[model samples]
Target: MAEQSSPDWMALARRGRRHRMIFLGTITVFLTLVSLPVVMPYLWLLTMSVTTLGSAAVMQVFWRAAGLVAVLYLALIVLPPLMPERFRTWVPAMAAAAAVILTTLFILPLTTLNNFRFLWNPDVMAAQQGRSSTIGELPSIWSAMGNSFALAGTQTALILITATPAAYALSRLAFRGRETLSRGILLLHAFPVMALTVAIFIQSYWMGLLNSILGVVLVLTTLELPFAILILKTFFDAVPWDIEMSAVTDGASRWQAFRLVVLPQVSGGLIAVGTFTFLRGWEEYVYVTTLLIDNSHMVMSLYLFWVSQDAMGADPNLIAATGVIYLLPVVALYVFAQKYLTQISFGGIKG
Candidate 1:
């Protein structure tokens, strides 16, 4: 046979790149189509919160708002890279201010904050409807928001305090039953906490934790411990022993070395664990509803429930507004912890 000519390498490379582009474009389109059903409801919820009811001009406001947002984000993506390094830092703040100003000019008049009046005016429904209602029995939105923060915050703290040390011990120490214990921890996490709701209720009642935020915090912290410990142990295992050894050689105690050197290395895991724990407590409804009998113990989840109850007239816009408010903390936490959360590592460290 004749010697094979060199393959058309450049043509093959071009074809490969073209195929990849087509595949990626197809995937992007498919995902966007799939996501629209899930995402459009939320988009409608936001628009309903801002758009005027019964107005023909509502779509006008939405398009204007969407345009402003699109431009703002486009500027964010395109302008930053073009600026000098020194001035680039200011672009985001300036862009944000521009977006706000554009919003005020284009959309503010068309929208109403009446839906959110419950934030400051507890009797907003009564005022809007000109009638007495069961809303009077419910706590103010502020009080409910405060209770949610307290419960979630306390629960997050408890998990961190307990899980961090437990994870470190399980990761670093050579002890009897360590492997079995590690597996058991994850197994416990897999078991449904909901299955024990009745037990938890009875236990809380016996312990006088029923109807108390403190009790809810403790219960939630306990439920979150297994997963938190497992996640954190992986982070601990990823840390190199040599770093701790160097610290020890420099005369640091084992505890000090672990705290200073190892802890910093696992900061990402700690943040990820804390964020999940906090969100778990924040969104917990079954336990809160089961254990917290009194309206005084209401959380954001229950508050939203009460707002949407037929007793409250189930005003769709108001309910949507409450939903938006309910989503803020979760969104804020993700925005802040996103950097570290992306650093989360699972499984054993490579040798």
Candidate 2:
């Protein structure tokens, strides 16, 4: 072989860059295509929530919102790199403001909140039926929302209360069967709790918690414990032992050291676990439906289900509005907890 005289480094770099660009482009296209099926329904739900199901305005608003999101995404991608490092942090906020302004100008005019009248209108089905005939009336949306909040909130509290100590023990203290117990907890997480619904229901009934939000809360918390413990233990493990030892050496009890020192260190993990636990309880439908016999105990999930069940002549807009409402809390939680949530990793802090 004629010794390759002076390899073209520039050409090789150009080729490598081009290949990376192509690969990234292909992956982006694949992801967008994959996401469309999952995303389009939510877009349609949001559109129908604000506009009549068959109205032309529905499509108009959809396209406008989609266009705005696309533009905002492009701006974040393109503008951030162009900005100085000090100014990069402001790009997201600026993009969000621009999006809001554009939405107000283009999309707001085509949208209406009439479909969400259920918020103030107690008897939605009755109002729709003009009280002359009835397809039966359930509790008010407020009642359902209240119950959902109570269930999710209580479940989160229970998970935090129980999982914290268990995780700390698993992470710090050494004892016989400790390793086995940790593995056992992880194993339990793999078991599908839904498969044990009948047993859970029977147990709830026996405990006199049937038809009660407390029953659902307890059930959800129990099923959630394994996951919560596993996640929290990883956080506890990430806590440096020196910090705890120093605290202990300074005359602090182990519980005191954990409560004050280790606890704050793992705050992100706790929030991550709690956020997921709350969302699980919030969106849970099966257990809530099965355990509770009364409409008064209906959760947002069951409420949305009932609203959607009016297949014969139910207003699709109303169902969509309910869905949008049901989604709001989850969206809000993720938005606020995004910082800590993103830091959660399998075996260590993301940073």
Candidate 3:
């Protein structure tokens, strides 16, 4: 009898390839659908920023067309894993490049550039001259921005200096009431800020700290301190004591060992703490408004409020533009600190 024919390997391989492509296509379509709701509002915001009228007619025509084009382009890039073997190798790289370019385009048009243009227009500025409108009498934008930076930077520095040592002691030293102290810190952090606002104000008034940036910074630092200490203590606990002791045995003092060895080990935690403190200071509104009654001492948060309620009155576009500017720094800070943030862990927490 004739030998049985060998199995058709190429046919089986082709069948497997076809099944894989079908699975990938289904996933790609599902992801695209899931992401649309999340992405559409941002597209509308971008459309409003670039054009004077975000009318329904314009949105339906222009925005829809642009979105369809984007979807098609994304599909073309994402579906390449189903392509021939030689081309599949480049699919991931191509998809990544496309993602970066699209993200930049989406973000660039929504920045402060358009706001600056409208704010500095010759006609707009001239119209405001000697006018009694609220917008006309607003404080300088540059000044408010400067105040925010100064307050945030100073508060972050102070928190870092104070919280680091406190965290180290809590993590390394055995002292009376140490566990109670940790519990108290967590409880204090959870305490309501609004509930204590009146007491804080009265204390600030008695101490002559009201209506000053320093006063605002001090309050923000206090609110931020408990969480900072908790996070840093966890970071310190994660660091192995053996390496620190080794440095001590090499003729280094305890302080020297900590500075040279342990500190570097917790750099990620330091970054996470600094970023949290800075953002809290930067976006502070309740304490700032309640404590700083003077209009001349306005930070960006208060300035934005004034612009919305008093200055730009009914102009939603101007408000949205300002809101974009307000959000950008926070976005940038998180983007920069995300890697360090992921390094922080609560795995070492103890009862």
Steric clash pairs (candidate 2): none
TM-score of candidate 2 on Cα atoms, chains taken together: 0.89
Clashing residue pair totals per candidate (backbone < 3 A): 0, 0, 0
State every prediction's TM-score relative to the real structure: 0.85, 0.89, 0.75
Answer with 2 or 3, whichever has the higher TM-score.
2
Ranking by TM-score: 2, 1, 3
Extract clashing residue pairs from model 3.
Answer: none
Please state the error at residue 250 of candidate 3 in Å: 0.9
Report the Cα lDDT for residue 156, model 1: 95
Misplaced by over 4 Å in model 3 are 1-43, 54-114, 118-136, 348-351
For residues 1-351, could you state the per-residue lDDT of candidate 2 as single tens digits? 898699899999999878977776677678778877987788888999999877889889999888886788666864564457998988889898999899889999999999988787766655654533333457788888999999999999999999999999999999999999999998999998879999998988899999999988888888899999999988988989999999999999988998899999999899999899999999998898899888778889988877766442567898888889999999999998989888778877877
Q: Model 1 TM-score?
A: 0.85
Give one digit per residue, the lDDT tens place, for model 3 in 128-190: 332435343455666778899999999999999999999999998899999999999999989
Comparing 2 and 3 by lDDT, which wins? 2
Clashes of 3: 0
